[model samples]
Target: MKKLAAGNWKMNGLAAHLSEAEALAGAHAQPGCEVLICPPATLIARMAQTLGDAPIALGGQDCHSADSGAHTGDVSAVMLKDAGASYVILGHSERRTDHKETDAAVRVKTEAAWRSNLTAIVCIGETLAEREDGKTLDVVGTQMKGALPDGCTAENVVVAYEPVWAIGTGKVPTMEQIAEVHDFMRTELTARFGDAAAGIRLLYGGSVKPDNADEIFAVSNVDGALVGGASLKADDFGGIIGALERA
Candidate 1:
């Protein structure tokens, strides 16, 4: 499976910012690993246009559980696919926190995304308190049981671990900590999902900036990263992509 560096530009980007997507697609037309950017929903169509036939894929930050609905301001997975998105991020730490999303909600959304043929990047993580209590693995395992659907496959599912304490806080877990979580995730997924779990990508999401990307990518089971702020700029994200290529 190709390593994936997926960017979640949550609630950011406009028509003027579409140039960064173009710059990324131009610079890394065919990096060794896969490149993806989930720009704000408003920029999806134009960004996809900017990245025509490029290796850099496009994704969405979130999606509604329903295929179609009367919910105002809610974009469904069906809508995201229609808008040219190949993937949709579900249960991001920010969405889980700000929206108070439970694991059951994430699973329904993942099923919806898969129904639309969109790969689901399901996020699972521990809060600062859970980490402090040494329950990170336990928390993540429980989330996997709740968020993942019964018929999931590697082709349609990816898992991202973003410590609530680390995301956008300029903080990062040690390489050992990251390795532990990734390895545990691989084990947990394999236990329930069977052989296909070996192919499922496990991504780390936090303060994944250029300077630390190379080392993070080197960790065992660390297939790639789910980028945040660094992904908003072409240069920074390109730097991370370069590191993954080298890894």
Candidate 2:
């Protein structure tokens, strides 16, 4: 399976920042991994244009459930697809905590992604206290079960495990810990969805940097990564991609 190295720029980036996208595209992307950048909505189309014929692909941070509605200030999956996004991230911990997005809401959005022919990167994670209490697997399992929509296939769906405590905190779990979580997730997914689940790519997120990407990607069941801070720079993101290729 090809590894996916997705950059979640979140709410950052402006018109001028599109140059970074150009830089990334101009650079050599790792041969064995897929590179994707999810910039702010305003820059998706432009970045998509800039990345034309390049190995890099464009993604969206989020998308509305409805194809078209009166929801003010909301962008739909169709709109994101029209803007040239091949993927849409959903149920990120930040969105769940900061925006109060529920599991059912994420399901709706996942369906929207399917309707628009966009791959959905569904995120699940646990907080520091939950991890301390040894409830990491339970929390992640519950979120995954609730957030994933029915009829999802490996081709159209991806799962990302992002420890809420580690994100943006320069913290990361040990290789054993990450392997344990990802292995458990693989079992849970296989039980729920059969062989199709076995093929679904599982990505690790939270504080993933170039220095540690190789070790993290080497862990069992960790097929790729969902990067945050390190993704802001072309060199850093490209370095991480290179690490995955070596892994």
Candidate 3:
């Protein structure tokens, strides 16, 4: 399976920000891995056009459950697809906390992503308190079981593990710690879904940056990353991609 290096520009970007996508397009992406940028909804179509044939896929930050509805402030998966997004992020910790989104809600959104033929990057994570209490696995397991939609294949779903405490906090788990969690996740996935799990991609998030990208990518079952702050700058994001290439 190819590694995925996705950038989530969460709640940021404007019309003029399309230049960032252009900058990313001009940069050399790591060979053997896929690069995707999930810009705010407004720039998806323009970014897709800017990155045409550049090996960089365009995506959406989030999507609504219903395809088309009276949901005044929501953007549906169908609309994202129509705007040229090939992927949609779901169940991000920020969204879950800020919007009080439940696992069932995430499942609905995941199904909506598939309905529009978009790959869903489903996020599962543990809060600081849960981790401190050694309930990380339990929390993650529950999220996965509840958020994942039925009939999702490895091709259509990518799992991202982002410890809530670490996101944008300049903190990261040790290599051993990350390996333990990822290995456990892989085992759980295999047990639940059988051989199909082997091909599924598992990505780590939360403070992943160019400096630590190589070591993190070297960890077992860590196929790639969902980068946050580091992804804002073309050079920093490109450096992480370079690390993945070397790894």
Most TM-score-accurate candidate: 1
Candidate 1 yields a Cα-based lDDT of 0.92
For 157-205, candidate 3 gives per-residue lDDT tens digits of: 9999999999999999999988988998898888888888898899999
Report lDDT (CA) for all predictions: 0.92, 0.91, 0.89
Candidate 1 lowest-lDDT run of ten: 48-57
Per-residue lDDT, model 1, residue 236, is: 98
Candidate 1 differs from the real structure by a C-alpha RMSD in angstroms, to one decimal, of: 0.7
Scored by lDDT, model 3 comes in at 0.89
Candidate 2, poorest ten consecutive residues by summed lDDT: 23-32
**Error of model 1, residue 73, in angstroms:** 1.0
> Better model by lDDT, 1 or 3?
1
Error of 1 at 3 (Å): 0.3
Off by over 4 Å in 1: none
Per-model TM-score versus the true fold: 0.98, 0.98, 0.97
lDDT of 2 by residue, 123-221 (tens): 999999999999999998999899998776788999999999999999999999999999999999998998888789999999999999989989999
Ranking by TM-score: 1, 2, 3
In TM-score terms, candidate 3 sits at 0.97
Candidate 3 C-alpha error for residue 113, in Å: 0.6
